[model samples]
Target chain A: MSITVQGRQAATTAAPAPPGGRSRGPARVRWAAVAFVAPAWLYVAGFYLYPLASSIRMGFQDYTVSSFYTGVAPYVGWDNYSKVLHDGHFGETVLNTVLFTAGSLAFQFAIGLALAVFFSRRFPLGGPLRSLLLVPWLLPLVVSGTAWRWILDTDSGVLNHVLLNVHLIAHPVPWLASTHDSLTAVTLVNIWVGIPFNMVILYGGLQSIPGELYEAASLDGAGGWQRFRHITLPLLRPVTAVVLTLGLIYTVKVFDVIMILTQGGPAGSSQTLTTFAYNLSFQQLEFGRGAAVGNLLIGVAVVFAVVYLRATREQRQAGR
Target chain B: MSRLLRTSRLFRPAARPGALAALAAAGALTLAACGTGSGSGGSGGAPDTLTEIDYYDAAPQNTQLPQILDECGVRNGVKIKHQQVPRAQFMPKLLQQASARSLPDLALIDNPDLQQVAATGGLVSLSKAGLSTEGLYPSIAQAGQYQGQTYGIAPGVNGLALYYNTDFFTRAGLEPPTTWAELAADAKKLTQGPRYGVAFSAVGTEEGTFQFEPFFWTARGNLKELDSPQAVKALTLWKDLVGSGSASKSVVTWTQADVNDQFMAGNAAMMVNGPWQLPTLNADKKLHFGVVPIPVPSPDAKPVTPLGGEVWTVGHSKPAREAKAVAVVKCLLSQDESAKWSKDAGYIPSNQRAAAQLASADPQLAAFVQEVGTAKARTTELGTAYPKVSQALADAIQAVLAGGTSPGSALSQAQSAAKN
Candidate 1:
């Protein structure tokens, strides 16, 4: 029975290959390939595809805690989506999400590029300093966020203390406590967390560029700014595209830093779409509405991903 | 092939680890929902053990409650496996279990949440199972009922009270405030460098609503009419406290636990908190604190604090297993056991007789015991709709305190939100 089963598996593995390849060795290779690919395919199907599909389905259903027990979530067909979209708080949440993502990406990429260029030049202690910069990226966001929360506490926080001593302002800033400042405070912490990630990737891309290009630019009597602008910028385009697209995806869905710091409030002032969705589902038990918000976020990420893929494809074709 | 691998590696990037972290963080809620739903219980016949779950993830209760459960289990001729999750995750986890039909045989749920969970039809009607609320406090008994069926029963219950530093009050030569006027005046007098006159949670969660409800109810504010003049007045009191710097602007961000920490650190002269802080407070030998009923709107008005505590519940399961669980719950809620649990856990005994004895014996509990008599159950008026109103109330409190929104406007907005 074992031999027959093995024969059947071998036949299945060989059937999908090119018409020329039917030998035992090639069939065994094909079987090994199946063995190699099976786990990843199963993992993607189980973790990503299944949950994504369930979330989409939930968005169109009137799911509640009662629905969980009775296994009867009545389909509502866009009611959840329409309700959340037209809700009073929805517009503010969308604005917050956009501000947070744009602010974090713009500053993170700028600071990261500057650091990457600065570190590219050989200097004393450069290697150790570059490695040390990664400490922020390595630590969990929860830890970083908690530390920042203490630092930003309005009354006795170290940031206020330093600012007071330096005469930066007359009074302390209510960083996480006031609606006006909470979003800015969370955005600042997010940029701090994201800088190291951006720097390391851009730095790696910098290393891959041939040093001879700089030498050729210099021979042509190109100044430092000219060489960096004309040569380095164009060469770094692909890496920069990857960095920004990935950064957008990561930043738009940021929940922990905001949660640990402000919990998406001082009256929902810092609430982005991610935290809003969480509040809907878990806090209010409006699971369908929460799923709708989550789907909207996923739509944003999908739009950016498609844009990135198309841009990269065009670049490839242009290169050819 | 090599070129293709290099191109794919470019897309993957060295930020692969960071990308993976983002994925894990983003998927947290969905992943929690996707937990394995295997029906993890006995197949048939009489099971010799039962499962219990609760959110008693703090020190005395975390260590003490399980020992009590084991004692009850031993008496009932069954072994018990007890589990705990953090408070925030408790309901979500329970709903997950209910969906799978693998709920623990026994559950200890928070009182205000009883109606919502019971509405899911996942709990056994304890009244039908021969459990009685005969001698329990009326508020606690009412909190455990859903649509006239008793689905839960508390061994002990608690309510919010004002916690003040006795040392600060003595130095300031003032009594603990009894009316809103005195409370505000005393709070302002107590304010000095690095010390706020008072502190309380206004964080945007149910704890905020729980802390604020005493004031709201005392001012004759009804949960059903959140934007009523009385509701606006109740919120205005909090706004004035923060606006006057008698309370920290940071109250908008503080939780009850944070309020306790500030009170202990001498950063705040007083705080609105619950009896649950007693164990932690008493553990600090140097801190001298006193508890009093939260100040009322007038000397003539009764302070109506929200009832707070957890209740023991039986879950749907095999009759034999559920019967055993009910026996364990009865043993846990017996007069002697309830008194002992209350003492160990810093809760007011749900039984009036036991609570009276406890209050007489322990001075710190006297205030809480007095309030629990007239304390209102949060869900009695709104039933399963209480959580939404509570959330709206919490948001109004935060908005009035932190966002500079007038109390009238905030409550008006909250009223609309609760309506939705």
Candidate 2:
């Protein structure tokens, strides 16, 4: 009896069933679709949409414990956003955020692509080498930041010790003391943490491409560089887009690296938008202004997402 | 129908299972509550007490607190559960928890943040708890008092003091500085190599403000009277110290740990640090140091230090827990416990009698105790504005030390910033 019912259900539910054939009612179909999507819809509503709305609401008022019971947070529309925009360090923080994001993405992708290409070929200790490369990503952010800070310390860092012993420079450089050096140091650490992700993603992309396509190119007398540029690069476009978009979004929200390394200092030289927002809210207790800054971050991420989606859609159409 | 069933396979069973389990749990909890409420209410039984105390401490767990708590709890017959949070995150976390009406029963609050808590009705008034504020060091107690009511109580005291390396002084053939001019001159003489004569945590935040306060007080300047000629002189002394290369530019960003590291490495001859660093210094065999009251720029001026410390207070709404909270606080703040805590933690005692009792045992603590009497608690109103005010001061100091701006101009900018 169960086998006969299962066969009838399968025949009725098959796509493009013969016209007027035995079929489940549309109401049943709609209910099934709702049942399938309800879990994800609930999850997004509970976590993402709820918090986003709360943050937006909080951005308009001086929402604090002191003001909560009194219900006296005067609505100063756009004032918080205006104040943050006009702050003296606003320009510098924006610039730092852009530079950090662009720099990390560029270096991480380049280094990772090279590693992926190298690892795609069979080599001695290939498995172990790949595992070792994953160590930085395996460590927690705090541990990585702290280890980097120690290694980059001005007086006692191992980096300085090695360089000075090798007679690389006459003076010990303060890696975190100056604005430029601190940026470089933090970028180095970010690149270190970011490379493994890029490698794994790109390697998977590389493995998916057919060997026949490359063999055909080689038969046509294609050079190594030409094969990489014409074949590998073109094939990796989708992965590249994903990597760059994700990397940009992640780097723009950088906090722990800067916080643990320089704390947006020697003179607020390394302050990024996220750290600025953090300081404004927690340290200065200016929640409205912090939320304004955070909203700006969301706006940036949205813009990047739109651009990435457009690019990916264009690539897919061209492939078709 | 089969395709629809396959597509919704994961969700159909999950929804039903979750709903059933939640309903069952709720029914069980309701039944359990009914049973408990009907259970025996014995008058002879100990009170059902669960108190959560939030402790903002950076001290290592291996030291004083566990031992002190064990001894005190046995004596007082109370078991206190402490949740240790880092000092930097404590205030903000407490503020969030306060808004949710879930503040801990007791908290170790900083002096500056205490005003905000008091303003928000986050703390309970100690007088309401039957605790007397009499015979307390007025300045120390001033930290926890808001609107003429004591909302918190200082367990111990910390203040800025001049720490000089005896070896550096001997090598430079100079005595420990007694005045600002002497300090500068000594610093210049001792700064022969990579080593600096003096170091102060002029980094942004309370550290710079605390270090700068003595200079301002010594020159007969005050925070309220920023435009005073004395203030300029005091400001210039700091400018000259950094300007002349007697102090390292590192001071602009150095924390207490940085100052200690420099002193330990013998890179700095003198530092204006708090009592918190004393334990580390004393434990180090390579260094011989002496602690003295911070000197003023003017020889005739009385030396002044800035008083700082933590306070223990219960949440405002926890009346039922008040009896146990008071018992724990009283036990912890008793003269014996306070003295032991002061000695062990390298902080001055909040209780004057306890301070004297500890001083007789440790001469180093005596110097700290003597300084505490002269220490000035930051103005109550100004303390409330500390987060903003301190940041402004730190930025100004950083600017001056980094040679990007002059002290006079920096102070003017800082005053404007502080006003906002």
Candidate 3:
């Protein structure tokens, strides 16, 4: 390198060389790097970590709106947590959340997979069709929720209007008037919002698979279904795993759809943990109990994240 | 040598005091700008300057109150920024703002939420503000009082009334019943085709509680005494109305708008509605209607109507803001402004003199005024526990009506839940 004395080599070799032949120079560089990252570190510490710590602390207190204003929210040591666990609706909320998440994920993934397959083919209008399909996803959540609400209204909704006009039934459907229908309606709205995301991710995954693998399968006399089964499905397993995990995490925290569409109404049949936590905090002004519910949600999410990370790491190790 | 180099790098960009001073000055200016316009009265002593007041009125913005307020502002020196939040969001938003100590200078507080606000120490006491309750309607003014002090000012009054579609009534050959029993019987007679005999908003909120209050009071029962025999009887009548198919089970989730929609669509013969629906009913030419006091269970019993209205209040945390807020309140409650408000907003004036003046101008409003005398204040305790108690009542009512729970059992549960 000394004989060549090239700029690239000099620049590359300059990093390890130090004045006074001391390793402390590299240590100082490390310190400088930390200093550069300090602002971002402090931001996360203040905004995210501090609030999260405070929320956990508040969960143990007998916090209420009255107490918050009066500055007398005394710590009650597990009382708030106990009260939430003992509540009659807590179990129902958990069950509903799980059902909603599972139901939405299944339908969204299926429809999205179907759309991805349909669009993967070289068609004349594939580009335009794919773009057109994203309208529902492009809509703001509140707008989507409201539009669905109008479509699902028991009396004058478009769905009922169309059904009745076609003589499908003699009566108007109570789309949001019953527990079952309300749940169904909310799930449908969620599925609609989630499908485009699934489609986009799966389409990208589908495009990455080598054409040679499919060609080899075709040369071996593999049928369309066989080619998809052996080649596409096996290759997309990693993408599928990622999609399902991310979708599950997102769907479990579904609140806006429930809140706007049904508001956990028809006797709170559509209530999820997120809405329950919200109602507890904002509606009931029971911040301690709300925080307890929030902590439960965080705990569930952490467990999910851990399981996902473990599975992903194992898969990566196997791949290596 | 490395240490020396590192130390030089660290001190390379030394802090500039002049630049830091400028940054600090900018922050101070921003903070001062944010602080200056806050509170009831502006810090600078300029009485003639327009005081900006934020009012959260649930009245539809397109209707008369906003228009009248705008006109009044031009006539008077004061300026009001009326924000029409949806009815369901108004109280919660107010509560949130109050909690944050970022409440507007003036807010239209619902009567039922007054106690909750007062408990939070968010409202400025009217007595302390040198405002006398002498000119206001006693019962209406009493609605805003909590802990022996007035914290809000009622500009108008509202109560539950029997609104009958004249067309439906005529088609069914039924007259508006004067007693609860007659109303039930008449409702049965009116139940034909797609139209229901009676429509009541049994939704999970104050609407359900307020609508049911008349029935309970007429039966000589109180929400406080939910286990009483009369309470059971009142609950039984509501259940019977739903169970017998005279009233729709859909009312359990129906909002005021739902009831109004059904009534306007001619799907309901008679509905238990409030004064707020008057303007909507008046605007629809095809639907003829009449407003009468809510019927009682027995003819001997007095017709009891649950009182409803909004109250104007200033935030207590900001004393200077209260002065500006009081000015806005005075401007809103002025006789001429109050008359226009009552006329356009479909609310009965709290100013008795304003009511008297308007009563002669509109005969229908005068008839409404006669019913105001019998309007009973909602129980302050129930009003305080409104969020919890109302949901409990709605659930209990729905169970009795839909789930076949006995009224006696349903009422017992309601009482327990309300107390808890």
Give the candidate order by descending lDDT.
Answer: 1, 2, 3
TM-score, structure 3 vs. true: 0.84
Candidate 1: fraction of native contacts reproduced: 0.55
Q: What is the lDDT of candidate 3?
A: 0.74
Candidate 2 chain A — worst ten consecutive residues by lDDT sum? A22-31
Residue A307 shift from truth in candidate 1, angstroms = 1.8
Q: 1 or 3: which has the higher DockQ? A: 1
Worst 10 residues of 3 chain B by lDDT: B46-55
- iRMSD in angstroms, per model: 7.7, 6.1, 6.7
Candidate 2 per-residue lDDT, tens place, A55-107, comes to 78778887664863343576788888888887877898898888888889999
| Two-way lDDT contest, 2 vs 3, winner | 2
Number of the top TM-score candidate:
1
- What's the lDDT for residue A265 in model 3? 62
Which lDDT value does model 1 have at B200?
95
Docking category of candidate 3: acceptable
Scored by DockQ, the top model is 1
Candidate 2 interface RMS: 6.1
TM-scores across all candidates?
A: 0.91, 0.85, 0.84
**lDDT per residue, candidate 2, B283-355, as tens digits?**
8898998887787666677777778887878774435555666777777777788777877778888888777
Residue B274, model 1, lDDT: 86
